[model samples]
Target chain A: MGKMELVDSDGAKLSSALNRIARDIDAVFDVLLPVPDDTRAPLVEAMRYSAMDGGKRVRPLLVVATAEMLGVSRDPALRVGCAVEAIHVYSLIHDDLPCMDDDELRRGKATLHKAYDEATAVLAGDSLHALAFEILTDDETTPDPFTQAELVRTLAAASGMAGMAGGQMMDMAAESADYDLHTITRLQQLKTGALLAASVEMGAILAKIPREGRSHLRAYARDIGLAFQIADDLLDAEGDEEKAGKALRKDDEQGKQTFVTLMGVEGARNQARALVDHAVGHLGQYGEDAAVLRALARYIVERDR
Target chain B: MGKMELVDSDGAKLSSALNRIARDIDAVFDVLLPVPDDTRAPLVEAMRYSAMDGGKRVRPLLVVATAEMLGVSRDPALRVGCAVEAIHVYSLIHDDLPCMDDDELRRGKATLHKAYDEATAVLAGDSLHALAFEILTDDETTPDPFTQAELVRTLAAASGMAGMAGGQMMDMAAESADYDLHTITRLQQLKTGALLAASVEMGAILAKIPREGRSHLRAYARDIGLAFQIADDLLDAEGDEEKAGKALRKDDEQGKQTFVTLMGVEGARNQARALVDHAVGHLGQYGEDAAVLRALARYIVERDR
Candidate 1:
């Protein structure tokens, strides 16, 4: 509750937790990718490069921290976390393709299509998508087949229609047509929030937490998910490209509607802060066990990139 | 079997069964596609056009027929069949992309990317891929979650790095390099046979048949898979495009080593005939329950297109 405690937990501890998860997930991907690669060298390399390339491991950390709080085993949690990252990265790769957003930079490096060919980029994304399901259904993901099926169903629903892909279609349409705040909010919910909400809920799914028990966590995730996008829009409007590791000012250049454009920078920032406060409040039941997630909700809105 | 029975079964009966399955799967695709016609019209339309436009739906028929013979309930079997068809159609849509085979025609119609734009085709394929896994893991796919999980695992393994995608990488590389019979055969096995084998195996899985009991069926699928590719090569060499629907003589034009190129036309035909016989012989244990499959193997080799 005190200012000093907030500074210590929110700043140093959050960064430390993020770093630890980054290392663990990178190791998971490293060991999991087949060695002695034959014909799949380019595809495998593209997958590894896109997935393991140093983006912030926010989703994985959410999976790990929430699962730990719920007393779930670290093994299945880590594998599930990696699967989420694979899907996330695959989405990024496809979103960056020439026929899509066509951005040349990602993670401070050339996008997959820019670095590799379009065909390899497509295959890498496609292969990673399959691998995510493969990992979730593997015996190593969970000994219980029922739990594995649940994860597969959860992720497939999160990433498919009425979810990420559907959100992307809405987004593509947004560039050509006029959209108000509600439509943009719905678009953001589908495009960005679906996976983020799913990521938080995965911790509960791994622990087999009851629906009622996890509702507050879902509330927390939904709040921060919107907050995350507002932060993204703020970054695009005013942040530095070197820090963000991708292009900035794209929304403005493309004449796309964003939180900043809709609400003004100051208003958008205030709203994001309000969302983070509500998100942190939803963790009241978890007490000290949710300290990391509490700090993350705050850190998410406050991060520079 | 009696000679008169073979004559009755081979000609009208096989075609009739194929027609029946083709219609059933088309109906399955029809009801499955969401039709509110909201923001996802383009994506939903693309998915419908590609999945329902037209194909043999051989994979779906394989799933339905084999499961029916195994006494598996029709509901789950039909859903699994649709899932397999979805995966197969997704592969076809992606394969016809400008970056891949760049084909203009499929099933006597313009390929998806040709009919629609490239990005829509990519999303359609990607969405269908996820839909396959989604359908497999859904509660509607089966009452037992374990069986559903097994289907997810099987389909993912058949389509990912060590399977179809890996095979595609090899196939792309083949254009730039010289490959022998063994390499091409391995490519064909992974590219085509893995999915076919998985399709046959799904029936056994749905029936809860043990691995040992399904081994002969797996063997049968493997043999016919190779025979199917050989027959394809012969079609590419000598068949009419109007009948085949897609472009012909592609293997020769691309200078790819195929069964017909490695073995003479007569030699390839003989090998395919032998494989069909072996495949049918493996089903001896199933008796008349597997009559459709036996006729299918022979028909695969005998059909001109």
Candidate 2:
């Protein structure tokens, strides 16, 4: 049902579609720039730092790969995919700002606000956040504006209070209090799972998938989102700083609760494996076409950093 | 071709459709949730604080008045108006946060972060922002889904960097450096004017006004947005805190330039008057039906606050 060679096996995998998607995403940022070109330099620079910095373009990969696997052209989905990545980058920029996480380094580079003033960093984050939806809603290539609008609403809801913001609040409150495994899982679901779910949901939306397939895709994303977060926690507990691009176990120093904190290190690892297995099983419903998605889930758990 | 009664001698008073439209806007906010429901309590309270905080609901008013003046039923426009107001309130809450403006008082009451904790405040602002578009894009609405989609694109652009955020960035930068009158005017246009223009533009859109008329409406809004900002600056210079709600003349202390700073009090006042006249002139093309919109512009300039 599929060609395996098209899927890269190397740890540093770079699919052609993924690379094109990244470039397309960068191009979207170039649109709608402010005048007096210098005024927008800081904004453009900070967004570049946050977005173009070294990290796998996983969210965008998910968007394009899913669309391709569904036997559709990737162009329309690519724009939406890039928009998703923009939102992800915006989140990371804000999360690392002085008022939020206050981290100095991201992907082994100085964080956006650390490189610039706090206010500029904040505006850059806000701008990127807004740009994400603007790109999705205003994409001329998308055939169905109504579907695009639904995608905007879906991403907004998942990325906003009921999801990411709620998780952030929980994370902040839990800093001073003890939280159990379930509480930690719920927070992770909101913070990470919400966007990931939206990624798949958006792909389905752009593909015009029927309701039943959409539900399964959503479930697949939900499982992967949690699995991905668990893998991240495990990596933070056991991975190396040079390899991971940031220090490991900083969450402990911050008194932040994660899957590793709520459960033992071994327990967290086991949970991640279980989730990956579960997510991959759901792909069975889609047959061989979901091969890349299955591999992606496995990579989340197995990757050293 | 005209009715003097439609224009209040004291101000540009609203006709019945416009007044009913405002009530209708409030009713949407007053969703019939059962008393003391735990899930909605926080959201409802936050919505009340954010929505009812009061700034004349100018954007919504523009939308409703524009729709009515174009001979559309006020009902559909009412929902959109409320949605725009929700977005406006959300932006204000975030703008007042410690991370942003760090304002303590708004409309003579403690800002959301001061009233609640910073985390709740941030989440509340985020929720309201998401809720705004959610209301507009809801499937239950009678407006065609495609039109709703277009509205999302328009509102998102107005609220995002190329519009509101662009204005905000300029405003923030203006505090630190020297700026000319053109710079100040540009900032005001992007920050306040973009949304104001969008308000009228969206109304024209909802009414399905002819493209030329819509463009004229936008031109009217552009002029009025600057005029409105000049009036605001004038008010800040001379108005009382009891009426203005915010501390009067803070812009001067902050070293922020305004039309008043660029044009002096009298010059800025004259510019505002001219803008009002121009706005009314545009309404003339629409005749007596647009009397409420004409009056609203005058009121925007002449209001004590």
Candidate 3:
């Protein structure tokens, strides 16, 4: 479990791992958010609707893969993965709200606000947000109080004003204001890169890796985060809507400048591939133990959705 | 500072303490939410606008007063207070959204969504929610990692589906459902009571008070929490908008069931007074040192706004 034994650095293994982690995460959410037999039932139901099954569970996979590579036990790794996934799911729910992206479709279904009302959607996102910290701070997540505190701090900072939400604010602004390449890069780093990087950093923290020891992991995460966003831009630009499971060409529709818009599809694709290779290179020190992580990096660019 | 040796538990002294704590909470927000010179500036600005210089700062006062009663230091108490207040303010921002209460005025000024756009308001609320956990888990909040983890667990539980948010969901249902007094009481307990109780509980946690030792304080908080809500219902039924600093009588307009509606104005007023008295009674063991907490309980029923 510590080294992902028997798993090869191939697309098949990565796909299986992704599927496994997705199911694991959904199970965790089921335990975390039971609908009460009371007036609050709808709120918990909405939370479950959005959080239980959806998305690639990429953040959770990142956490578990990184932790397992670093010799952490599977139980703790999976719990940490669930915590990160909860935050990711909550963000998606909020992002799809009418006042925000106003997206009707997500994860191949109507968004939370469409399935429930806007109020329930808002509360559901909030409850899931709280649930993430709840899971991280619970004694069962990890016995070490220090690790719990660190996890809470890391996730909160990444999700707040200077991280995902801030990045989203910048994205909202991009529709009206002209953003240069640097500003857009910064925005993407905050919006998506922050949480992605945090997912890896949290695994390192759980493994008791010192701050200095995390530099390579941080670098690996940074490269893949950028690559992931680039690939997302490419997907939004040209990937099939059915395969992607959501709307595409949104940046174009909104007239927002994206990596694809700024660098052209060919330029963006080349950049993303280069980043994937560079990211995989960072894991060379770990040899075979980092194989899964290496494959994850490649999968970022190769995945159709 | 722990004993409040020089101050008596008079109304004037309580008034001064409230004002002092209000300023202290504002100062903390000023430092915690500085607007960066970037695209995220508007988001931070909106957070600052909503989180600072408003409300009674009652939650923080509860934290500080309770912690001080148990001999916790002022600095840490203030930090914890700020953390709880952050959650409270964030909830207010979301509660006032168009999809929720659709409030135009709050604390005598335009609500966050009215002052800024709906999207900014949502992000600002979300950022502050993250900020609360960020503050709670910071080493500066407490030297003890255990205390940090405990604080996070307490706040998250009180803020999530089973606490404030859950209570809010019940309130939403009251608009259409025929809520009896029992259901309304249960709703208020989750909505406002949980956070209020947590404020006291957090102070006890900071002081390392054993769980058994916190029963009296918990009782005190429960009584005050209900009294606070009853007082709110009373104000909504008959209080002035200018004095209350928000639109009142919305409960009557919406035809929602509330304490006042369920128990009649006189019955509700008497119940609040009785609860305040009972709340103060729970502090008898603390003697003169519990003066501030007792005053707070009394103030819950007596405050006009």
Candidate 4:
């Protein structure tokens, strides 16, 4: 096949995979969160609303794609995908609160706090946080208790203070502090990179690939994580707000130092491209089986959203 | 010993145990949440401030006492106790948010949101929620992966939508809804009772007691769980704010239906006493070795705060 044809084919495959996983995740969340006929119904409804039919499902797609490439079955992979998505959704719900990012729109709809009251939004986010662990430890997710425990540890470490929340703290400080490129990189690594890396790590974990064997995959995830953030910054700087589906340019508005601010737009774009190239190189060992992942890495930079 | 002497001795033992576990949990949290010399420092400080030196350490005490009674070592029990306490602390932080109960005082000090900013408070609670699972799944907590997974499942179930958060949702609705006694009972069961029951259940889990063997312990937990909430309601109705160290009678002010509202003060007191007696009776299978558990049940009703 010609190079252009190869790019087109890979792009088609990635798009199809993304669409499929998004639907799968929505189905899983539907089954996971059922509204009860009681006072708690609104809470469950809010949780379902914020969790389903939202986002690019990038985290879940990464998990499922990487797990499948490693010869793992799709059932466990989808369940684990849902677990990571739950964490992602919960964080977004909390982040969009009036006290945090205060964004009114998410995934082309009202944020959780706007859709429901703040109290219900907080409880719903918390419930989803708990649901992540619940799904991981459930026997139906994986009968192997060791795998279950390992999954929980991976996710908890990535989501907790030293990881996503810690990164967020740095981001919050970015509004006031004079952050250099090094600080911004570290901030992004924790806030966004950690969970992205965890998605790949969890895939290897489900395959029982052994920690030492996952260096290449970790490098791939790290590169793509950075590239993804840069692209996000670029989108916030120049991409269409309607396509992004949330308020863009808020980073600039907040005077928060980001990749685009630290590095010029051209410099940041080149850096993201370099990272994507490096990320794809790490997957050369997996050959064609890694096509979707490589495509995902490219998609991280290429997509408007 | 005479009945009076036995009662006095048990009370003394329970008090000492409570004090000791409180210190132990604080020390564990101190180690677990050291303030890093970075932007995340404030987040860690907020977490440490709320998690340590507060709240009677009742959950941790229950985990340790019950585990020790079942012949488990103290080290693992303390770790598990810390895990449960982390969940309890996180819930309290979230419940005290301005959008929630809006309480300024917790554990005789300012609530987390009052101490830190609202965003930091939200992140700290989320971090602590993640930390609970992290502690449970750590190899140091339990060498057995099965046990670790089980612990995560128990804590997650108790703290999530079907548990404490679900109950909190009901509690929030109580301000506007006309709830009957049955609804209130169910609400309390999910809110306060779930974690309380999980504390005892976790001890049984750590001891590797089979599900069938845990029947009496489950019954004991169920009884004590209800007794604990009823006692709390009574405290809210008439207990001294100085003694409680927080605002009291807010339930009456909110016009919410509580155990005190559904059952009058004398009726609630009798119900709590009956629950304590029933909880203690269920521990007969453990004989004198269950003395601490029995004391804890009585203390649930007897505690002023």
lDDT of each candidate versus the true structure = 0.87, 0.74, 0.90, 0.92
Residue A103 displacement in candidate 4 (angstroms):
1.0
Candidate 2 residue lDDT tens string, A1-305: 13345335522243454466667665654553433463545666667667763567778778877887787677777777767887787677767765566688887888887788766766676677777767777757475777777787788888766677657666766777577777788888888999888888887877778767687788789899998998898888888788787657878888877888778888988988898878877777777677667777777777766
Q: Report the lDDT tens digits of candidate 2 across residue range B175-232.
A: 7767898778888888899889888988887876656758778888988898899988
DockQ values of all predictions: 0.81, 0.46, 0.87, 0.94
Model 3 per-residue lDDT tens digits across residues A270-303: 9999998899889889987886788889888888
Docking class of 4: high
Better of 2 and 3 by TM-score: 3
lDDT of 2 at B281: 81
> Which residue runs of candidate 2 sit more than 4 Å off their true CA positions?
A1-24, A27-38, A254-257, B1-6, B9-12, B15-26, B30-48, B210-213
For residues A1-305, write the lDDT of model 1, one tens digit per residue. 69678658666777888888889999999977864356668889888888884888889888888898899988789999999998899899988998889999999999998898998988889889999999998898887887888888878888986788988888888778778899889889888898888888988889998768889999999999999999999999989999999989989888898899999999999999999999999998988788889888888877877
Regions of candidate 3 where Cα sits further than 4 Å from its true position: A1-9, B1-9
Please list, in the order the candidates appear, how each scores on TM-score for chain B only.
Answer: 0.97, 0.91, 0.96, 0.98
Ten residues in sequence with the least summed lDDT for candidate 1 chain A: A31-40
For all predictions in the order shown, the interface RMSD in Å is 0.8, 2.8, 0.6, 0.5
As for model 1, its CA RMSD to the true structure in angstroms is: 1.5
Residue A44 Cα positional deviation in candidate 4, in Å, after optimal superposition: 0.7
Query: Best by TM-score, which number?
Result: 4
Better of 3 and 4 by TM-score: 4
TM-score of each: 0.97, 0.90, 0.96, 0.99
Candidate 2, clashing residue pairs? Answer: B12-B295
lDDT (C-alpha) at residue A87 in model 2: 75
